[model samples]
Target: MFGPFRLTSPLSGGLLWKIPWRMSRPQKARQRARLRHVDKVVSIVDQALAKKGTTTAAVERWKAEMPVEQEMLPRDKYTIFDRKEKKYRKGIHKLPKWTRVSQRLNPPGY
Candidate 1:
């Protein structure tokens, strides 16, 4: 008794949302710009704090641990490590809120 009146499933199987396999060139450019802006902001803050003759542990740790934009390899800047992904890497954009979050590091030798 299957007909338009019969109810089982309203939709067939298919991908509801498709994510791009990789980022476009313009997106990469924008990502780089954002990285540079973050670096600039950090340096500005450090300078301002120095002028005031004070430094916070957070600022010191950031400078000690994070490599500035110029020092990061393009691979590290644009991709992140994922154990399930082929070649153990996936595009940064694959992560939710990637633009707003800083993903500047991966496991060493990943």
Candidate 2:
């Protein structure tokens, strides 16, 4: 045994373990409700898709609600073209005005 020469992660401070969590009543109810809603929606979609010859009204409505893809500008420098906003927006090119330790947290090469 290599005494004190331990292979452990610095991120875990040489110790790592799982903490068992008990879900409260509200949390359990919320998860169940979300899962039930998703299951219902999926089943409806499957039924609509199963009938081959004629397209169901629900399928047509869903297709109409689907969003269309938009064109995007090449992301090289600062500004990016926002598809939803229909505008060019600024990104990582803003001037920093941090004092003391705050200045160190700026993105790499900034």
Candidate 3:
């Protein structure tokens, strides 16, 4: 004979079941913040793209014209990730160390 297994225990009640159903408060808050930031960035890019004919060349030109100090400018300004290897052909220019440091520390979305 198997021992009696009661479904309702004093310590394990509705609260125990509810715990899994509830989202972690901190995780939810972080997700909301990330969504907001992504939306803002998308809006800014969209606004910039909307001004002219919205062509690839126009976007590339606009990106190239941006200041190097700006976060968005480095990739385009330095052309480090360029597939054509035009700018960094001689390997004189390199990404700053701080970029890697920040990337490791902050990460994408917490």
Candidate 4:
């Protein structure tokens, strides 16, 4: 465990891997699909609530505050604000759990 392999890893103060600065086209496509799936789930829930004569405030607030995937600009869809990054932005894919977490919004004028 003290040879070249471990020596070159995080335990030895070296990065084990690096995330790319940009997402590949296929990755972007998958990201889009995930966004669409989330949108679909929200819409379905809204419809269900409508039929039940009740709507949750959280869902209503989400619909009001968040843009649907189709409505987002390319910049918003692909990147997020990062105060430490050059130009104050970074690729969303670089975030941990990018596929599982919702990160569709950023502060205005960033």
For this target, which candidate reaches the highest lDDT against the unseen true structure?
Answer: 1
Per-residue C-alpha lDDT of model 4 across residues 20-90, encoded as one tens digit per residue: 88988998899899999999999999999999999999899989999999999888888999999999999
Top model number, TM-score: 4
C-alpha TM-scores of all predictions: 0.85, 0.30, 0.29, 0.87
Candidate 1 ranges with C-alpha deviation above 4 Å = 1-16
Q: Model 3: what TM-score?
A: 0.29
Give the higher-TM-score candidate: 1 or 2.
1
* C-alpha lDDT score of every prediction, in listed order: 0.90, 0.37, 0.39, 0.89
Could you tally the backbone clashes for each prediction? 0, 0, 0, 0
Residues 6-47, model 1: lDDT tens digits: 643433455554668889999999999999999999899999
| Candidate 4 accuracy as lDDT | 0.89
Stronger candidate by lDDT (1 vs 4):
1
Point out the worst 10-residue segment of candidate 4 by lDDT.
3-12
Superposed by TM-score, candidate 3 places the C-alpha of residue 20 at a distance from the truth, in angstroms, of: 6.5
Candidate 4 regions exceeding 4 Å error are 2-7, 14-17
Q: For residues 27-58, what per-residue lDDT tens digits would candidate 3 score against the true structure? A: 44543444345446555776777786484664
RMSD of each: 6.2, 19.3, 19.1, 2.8
